[model samples]
Target: MTEQLLSIHELTKSIGSIMPVKGISFELKRGGCTALLGPNGAGKTTTLRMLAGLIPPTRGEIRYGSGDGHTDSWRHRIGYLPQYPKFYSWMSGMEYLSFSAKLSGLSGKEALRRSREVIEMVGLQQAAKRRISGYSGGMKQRLGIAQALVHEPELIMLDEPVSALDPIGRREVMDLLDRLRGEVTVLFSTHVLHDAEEICDDMILMVDGEIAEKGALSELRTKYRQPVLSIDVEPGEREVAWLDSLANRPYVQEIELGKRGAKLMVTDMGVARAALIQELADAEIQLLRFEAGTSTLEDMFMKVVGS
Candidate 1:
């Protein structure tokens, strides 16, 4: 079995009376990627910062290396990148990585060598000598990641690494993260669940100030997925009324109404399908479209977050 690299217990953080993170707990296995997923103001950034040791926890314990206190060396084995990483505008990408490596206690020669390697790893080789001020948004983000990885830390924590990038840039960073999987333990925070789904094996879903769900992505999907029925009818008063009335049916567990459509979460797809078909026939409703499928990760996310 793979070892648990980090074990956090009831971690809490409050700033002056506003508690962003309220007693959240989870574990990260070695060489696994876990997404700290949440909506805006879900305390994801605060949690990541606490894990990276940037801020002291207001309460609870974070254990590393068999939960022992013998050595603080675990500090040296972790890398972190904030939501918006600022760099020395005058410094080139290569210079900054080397500088960061040296700050993390590497020898000058080792720092230079590692810096070059990481720059290439993050596709920053061509822009290695480019000044930070001249780099694009995506380039700067990648450069930030390069610096974080220069020392080859065992665990890397990133906060919304792709949140600010364009679609192409987001795709690029996500691909890099996919490559990083299983190479090192990663605990990155993201509001975009699809991004997490694309790269992570596990996820800790947060809402408000606490975790609403945490598990392997596949397991969570299986647990939350249910029979979903989508119905479309032409714009008409009777059509909307009939669609809305389906929500009150016992077999129809939940309903989301659209302009000319309704998505229903059914308790039993087979029974619900029979009843709905009978009703449509009786009313002679003009059914434009009907699709029955399983719920998705995004549906589960909205349900848990209640937003």
Candidate 2:
């Protein structure tokens, strides 16, 4: 029970000429849920696997707890679920959890008891007896979580846990993770910024296999926060051209264009707003929608990655 559950220092993973994770470093707090935020191929999975002892890093160290930073003797304290968790299609959920429990060093009786308990904790009790082949995608993900938790590890690391699931399935897993927060120090990787913002107080943002930003969610939000204007016009050549011209406006800092709309990052919201409205009126462009708001967490994510 140290306050720091884990600390990664100058962690580097190199493969020949390609470096998947380059000198990344961060710390995870005890009993805190942290999101490894990044897009595809950002080395998120690699980082998680390395931390989970699936692979050794090319350079750097991972210190578990406040101990002497020993690498060995820390596996039992961790639980991991990969993005695509594999399981025997014929095995029932209960069987899989029990097997995993035993693999984690629990005795037969302990394994069974833990399996039953975790099955109920993840809301898989109803489907615990059913074959894996018959369970839905969401149920299977829950079972994967159950297996991970069966050993009652101190920290759980999940790699892109919800990326493969449908909306409903994703919500189910997210909700479960939210509930598990504070109970177990959770570290989950996800490219979806909104998901991280929703449940995690801390985040490690990655881009191109390197750390882009890492901090408490509130701090990062304020650090990247800015005035934003989202505008949508009817899909027509004239309207599209009008939107394109706004990119060169003096007050606009950046612009992300979409099919029917564009989100503009502005230095001065009031000036840009009045000018943009005048330009639209003068051109008689068909305005479909308009909004004034601050940069969202997703916007900040894109900006950091892009930077």
Candidate 3:
């Protein structure tokens, strides 16, 4: 059996009149990459902050380590990067990391060694000596990650690491995260399902401060996979009526109608596809696009968050 790295039980946080996190519970396995997924205002940041020991939970327990033994000094065993990381702009990348390492309790000599090692690990070796003010958004984010890793903690928690990056910067950070997998236990929070799907093996989805779903990514995908059909036709009176009429079909379990198209959750892809193609041919409708496939993680994400 895999070792349990962390176990959180009924964790709740309340600030005055509002409760952002409401008794959430979950566990992380050693060396696993797990994503904490939810939309904005879903308490993901608050939950992560609580886990990182930056804020005290209003109630509940957080246990760290394998077996029956747990530690209150779990802070040193985990590293955290906030959603918005602050930096001393005057400091060089190397200086920043070394400072962070030392603050995490490393000696000066060891801090310098770890800083150099992690700067290279995050592909910031070329910018190591350059002032942080000159670093690009991606570079700064990478620097944030490096500082999180400088102490070689058993676990690292990142809060929406790529939410602010441009396409190029997002790709850079994503690739770095992919490389870091299996080397450390990662628990990162993000609203984007695509990012979570790309790198995480497990996921815990929070909606309005509660765990709506939690499981291995593959298992969740398999559980939620369902036949779906998308159809688009050139707009005309007949085409518009026909698209709307798809909801009345017995095979279509659910339908979302648009001006030029409809997305259908169908009971049987084969029956639905054949029937739709035949109807289009018979009516001489100008087809723009038609697709038949299983629903994706995004579909599942929308369903959970929308509810």
Worst 10 residues of 2 by lDDT: 298-307
Q: After superposition, how far is residue 48 of candidate 2 from its true place, in Å?
A: 0.5
Deviation of model 2 at 131, angstroms: 1.6
Query: TM-scores, in order shown?
Result: 0.90, 0.83, 0.86
Could you tell me the lDDT of residue 63 within candidate 1?
Answer: 85
Ranking by TM-score: 1, 3, 2
Candidate 2: stretches off by over 4 Å: 229-264, 267-292, 304-307
Candidate 1: the clashing residue pairs are none
Best by lDDT: 3
Per-residue CA lDDT of model 2 for 56-124, tens digit only, reads: 999999999888656568888899998899999899999989989988999999999999999999998
Candidate 2, pairs of clashing residues? none
Model 1 scores a TM of 0.90
Ranked by TM-score, the better of candidates 2 and 3 is 3
Q: Per-residue lDDT of 159-241 in model 3, one digit per residue for the tens?
A: 99999999999999999999999999999999998999999999999999999999999999898889989988999999998
Where model 3 places Cα greater than 4 Å from the true spot, the runs are 67-71, 231-250, 259-261, 273-291
lDDT of each: 0.88, 0.90, 0.93
Clash totals in order: 0, 0, 0
